[model samples]
Target: MKRVDVAYVLLFDEQHEKVLMVKNKGANSSYYTLPGGAVEAGETLEEAAIREVKEETGVDIEIGGLSTVSEAFFEERGHHALFFTFTGKIVGGKIEILFPDEIEEIKWMEIDEAETYMYIPEKLNGYVKTNISIPYILRGNVIDKG
Candidate 1:
């Protein structure tokens, strides 16, 4: 399987009450996930996170430390994807669907509520709720059974 690198930024509001998420278009249209995308060649994870968030949600963010690292295998596509999720804060820009073709919607939802919509990483809710003093590393074969 070919390895793919992806970067995701988890951004919470000032009160840290709600998290920023985007409803993707196409196949997983109903699922809501963090504002992020694939890391292009020569771009750092932090840079990819910032660029993806701006392109998908029209929100600019400054990434903090690494939050979690996850791996998912797409059985059908023969892809091994590495997900690097980082803690981030909104630095500027407004909440809007910059690429309506790729992003269905953008919203800030409570952590608990958002977890229900984010089904990929089963332990994501706990990670986000905890005090991220140390980086969380999760290792498993997350097969894309869907």
Candidate 2:
């Protein structure tokens, strides 16, 4: 299978009470997820995280720590996706829909309220509590890595 690299950021307010998220405006979707996307060539994971957030939300952020690294196989996409997630804080820039065609909406929702609309819930679960996290590398529900 082919391989892909993706980087995401978990940005919260100064009080850590709210998170930045974006809603999809696609023809067949009603889910909101963190602001992030693919890592382009020659850009570091941190750089990609910063760029994706800006493109999606028009917000500049200061990346903190590497919160998680995960890998998943997608039968539909025919590829193994490697994900790098980091913690960040909004340091500058105003929140705006830079890409209206791609995003239905963007907002700062309370951390607790985000549970209802976040598309990839696993990506955010227990996220802020740790500096590093990795999902089980498993096959057939059996742990495949230590």
Candidate 3:
């Protein structure tokens, strides 16, 4: 099984009321999640974050501080992945779904609304504004399967 370090770019609107999201295409087409992808070989975490967002959303972004993280060993998928989620700033481009085969729709969603549609809603359930913890990191390996 291959091991991969995945990165996600979390971009909020100017008002910070909404978050950028993508309803993905392909296998998990119905799943709504943040826009980002795998961290390729030799790519820095920040570079992966920026590249993923652009490739998925066609929007150039300036990555910010690490927002959250989680690690997963997917027995079903036959791989283990470490995930990094980072805050991002929109530097250019529009909300264009770059890869139609992989991305179905793009939208800026309300925080509450986003949580409801997230692939892992519990990741934010007990989160507080002051305390920042890696999303879903405490969940067990086999039992806490997404």
Candidate 4:
């Protein structure tokens, strides 16, 4: 299987009431996800997270800590992905969709709404509402086996 690594950043407003999210324009449909993307070759997870956030949302972030680690296998596609989520604080820059081709819109969504619209809700439950000290882990397949 081909292994892919992705990093995401969770940036909350000063009040910690809203999160920064991006709506990605996929081939078949559009979906909301945190501001992040795949890790580039030779780049560390933290570096990738910061770079992706800037590219996708024009926001600069300082990673605070790892929030969650999720892995999924796509049997049919012969792919495995390791997703790292990190909590970050916005250090500079403003919100903007830097890549219009890949991202449609960027918004500061409410915590409750973000939970509902996130691509992987379960992976976010642990840290979305309550900040956990340890990274929440999720391991499974993209498709059901049963």
User: RMSD of model 3, in Å?
Assistant: 7.9
Candidate 3 ranges beyond 4 A from true positions: 116-146
Cα RMSD of all models vs. native, in order, equals 7.4, 7.8, 7.9, 8.0
- How many residue pairs of model 2 clash at the backbone? 0
Q: Which ten residues in a row have the lowest lDDT in candidate 4?
A: 137-146
The backbone clash count of each candidate, in order, is 0, 0, 0, 0
Among residues 3 or more apart in sequence or in different chains, the pairs in candidate 2 whose N, CA or C atoms overlap within 3 Å are none
lDDT of 2 by residue, 5-99 (tens): 88877777667778788986856775687888888888767678889999999999867666567788989879898887777778889999998
lDDT, residue 31, candidate 4:
94
Given candidate 3, what's the lDDT at residue 125?
62
Writing each residue's lDDT as its tens digit, candidate 1 over 106-137 gives 88898888767545366555667763733433
lDDT of model 4 at position 17: 91
| Predicted candidate 4 versus true structure: per-residue lDDT over 27-127, tens digit per residue | 89999999998998988777798899999999777776676688889797788999888888898998887789999999999888887765546655634
Best by lDDT: 4
Kindly provide the TM-score of model 2 when superposed on the true structure, using C-alpha atoms: 0.76
Off by more than 4 A, model 1: 119-125, 131-146
